[model samples]
Target: MPVLLTKIEGKGNGIKTVLPNMSDVARSLSRPPTYPTKFFGCELGAQTSFDEKNDRYIVNGAHDAPKLRELLDVFIDKFVLCKACDNPETDLTITKTEEILRDCKACGERTGVDMRHKLTTFIIKNPPKNPKKSKVKKATADGATTPNGDADEDAGGDSDDELTLRIKAEAAELTADAAIAKEDWSADTSPEAVKARMKAVEASMASVSLAPAGGDDDSDEDGDSPFAHLGHWIEENREESAVEIYKKAEEFGIAKKHNTMTIIAQTLFTENVLTEIPKYAPLFAKMVTSEKHQKSLLGGLERLVGVLHPDLTPAIPKILMAFYQTDILEEEVITQWGTHVSKKYVDREISKKVRKASEPFLKWLEEADDSEEED
Candidate 1:
C-alpha cells in the first residue's frame, strides 16, 4: 500500500492534500475509496471530495502522508478487517436493523461494526452491493426459465427417468447365480501362494522405486532435462522482453510445462530480483498457471535466493510478497511452501535458511489460517 501524495498549491482554501493513488490503495484493501476518504474527513473534521471520474481523492487542508496513513490504519481496523479472523476479505452489509455487519469469506463469521462511529451511518446509507445475488438472478433467468415455465418439472422428470433407467440397467446386470458366485468367491490361503504373492509385490515395488531414480539420473547427466536447457537459454537471452522470452520458450515446447517457471525464476533475475520481479511478472503469470507451476517457480526461487544469491536470502518475505502481489503466487501455495523445507529445490541447509528468513510472512499466514479455523 504505497501512498502517492500530492500537496496542492494556491490560496488558503485551494490548498489541499491530494491522494492520487487512493483508489489503488482502496482496491488493495478491498474497500471503496470514498469510505477511507470520508473517514479522514470525519477524523480530521475537514472536508473531503472524491472525483471518481478522474480518480482523484482530496482531503481538505494540508495533511501529511504519514498522518493520513495512520488514519487509514484506524479505518481498516474498524471497517475493513474481520473481527473474528482479522482478514481483509470481508463484505460490509447493512442489516435490516441498521447495524453494519462484516461477513468474512475466510472464516464465515458475521461480526457487527460499531454503530457509534460517524462512518457507520454513511456505510448504512451507501451499502456495498452484492454482485452474487444479481449473478444468481441472471443465471436463474437464463437457465431455469422456459417459454412454458415448466423447466423445473421437466428437469426433475428427466433426472428421475435417468435414475430409473440406470437402476433397471444395474438390476439387469445382476443375476441371482452371479450374486451367489460373488458371495462364494474366496482367495487362496495356501502358504506357497501367499509367499508367491508377497514376492511379486516386493518385486513390483522394487522396480517402481528403481525406475524413477534411474530415469532421473540418466536425464540429468544426459543433458535431456528441459529445465536445464531452458535455464541456459534464458540466462543467455537475459536482455530480451518477457513476451520474446515466452515465444522462445514456446518454440522449445516447454512454455506450458510445469518446470519452465522454475527455470525462468532461476535464470531471469540477478541479486536485484526484488526490483526486477515486476519486470518479469508477466512471463511468470504466463508460465505459472497451476499449483504445480507455482511450486516449481518457488523451487527455482529457492535456488535463486538460497543457493545463487545468499545475500538476497534474507529478502525471502519481500520476494514472496512481490510474487503474491504480482498474482504469480497464491496463498495456499505459499503457505504449503513455507511449512516444509525440502532438498528437492535446494540443499537441506540452504532450504532451512530460506524458510528461516520467511518466518515472519509464514507466521502471519499461519495466524490468519489458525484464526479462520478457530472461528
Candidate 2:
C-alpha cells in the first residue's frame, strides 16, 4: 500500500502529518481507517485526530512516509499475518476467556495473539465489521462445487456407495446405542423397598441442623444470609460515609468474604452510577486488594447494570470508562470482564448484552495502552 504523507499548516497542532489515502490503505488491509491512524499515534507518542466525515487522518508532529510505512508493517505482522503459515488471510476472534485468537483460512491453523500488547484490546472491542467466513467445498461422486460456484470433474460411482454405507453404519450404531440406553432404567416400588427408603430419608433428616451450631452470636440477623444482611444494611444506611460502611462491614464479620465487594457494588449505586463512581472509587480501590476481590466487584457491577438497573445497560461503556479512569478497575480486569459472559451474576443473555455495551470503552482502553507503551 502507498503512504501519502502531507504537511498540514494552521492546524491546532502546527505542521501535522496527514495521511490522505488512509481510507484506501485500511481497505486493502481489511480494517477500519482509525486502526492504523490510532496505531501511528500510539507508536509515535503523538496525538491523533480523525475526521471521519472528511476522511482526514492526522497525527501530531511531522512524520515521513518511510517511518509510517515501517510502523504499518509492524502492525500488519502483529495483527494481520498468521503465525503458522505467515498468511494474511486470517480472522480475529475474542474468546469467552478474553483470548484474541487469529484463525488462518489458508492453513486452517488457530493461534493466539499476545495479550500483553495494547492493540489486542482495541481489536477485541472493534473486531471485524463482517468477518470473512471460510467456505467448505463438499465433494461428491458426481462433482465438487467451488467457492465461486464452479464444479469440478466427477468421481467414480463406487465412492458414493462407500460413503452411503459408512453413513448408514453410523446411523445404525446411534440407534442401537439409544435403544440400550432406554433399556438401562428400572425403579423399585415394592412395599418393603418404599418403607426402607422412607426410613433412610427420615434418618438423614434427623441428622440435619436447622440452626447455627451452639447458637452462634455472629449468625445473621433475621435469618438472612450474611451477604443479604450486608446488602440490606448498606441500603438502609445509604447516607453513611464510605469509611463508615467499610467499618460496618468489618463489624458484620463478613468483610473477608469474596462477595462482600459484590454486595457493596450492587447496594451502593443506582441509575446515577456513572456520575457516582468517582465518589466511591477510593473505597473500591482499597477494598479490591486482590484479583478475587476485583472479580467479585465486577460481579456486583454485572448485577447492578444487568439486573438492578436494566435501563442503564446502554451506558455500560461509559460506566466502565469511569471505573477505569478512577482506578476502581484495572485494564486487565476490565478486559477480562468485557470478554467473558457469565451467568454467575446475571443471565447469560444479560451478561452478553452488558459486554456488548462495553465494547467502545474496551477499545479505547486498548489504544491507550499502546500509547503508554510507546511513551
For every model shown, what is its TM-score relative to the native structure?
Answer: 0.42, 0.41
Q: Write the per-residue lDDT of candidate 1 for residues 296-317, one digit (tens) a residue.
A: 7888788778756689887787
- Record all residue pairs in model 1 with backbone atoms less than 3 Å apart, i.e. clashing: none
- Whole-model lDDT for model 2 versus the true structure? 0.63
Question: What pairs collide in candidate 2?
Answer: none
Off by over 4 Å in 1: 1-221, 369-375
lDDT of 1 at 127: 76
Measured on C-alpha atoms, candidate 1 has an lDDT of 0.65
**Which ten residues in a row are the worst by lDDT in model 1?**
176-185
Q: Return the TM-score for candidate 2, rounded to 2 decimals.
A: 0.41
lDDT of 2 by residue, 131-236 (tens): 1111011232256442223453444444433432443333334312222111111224455744553343222212111122223324344444555556666665
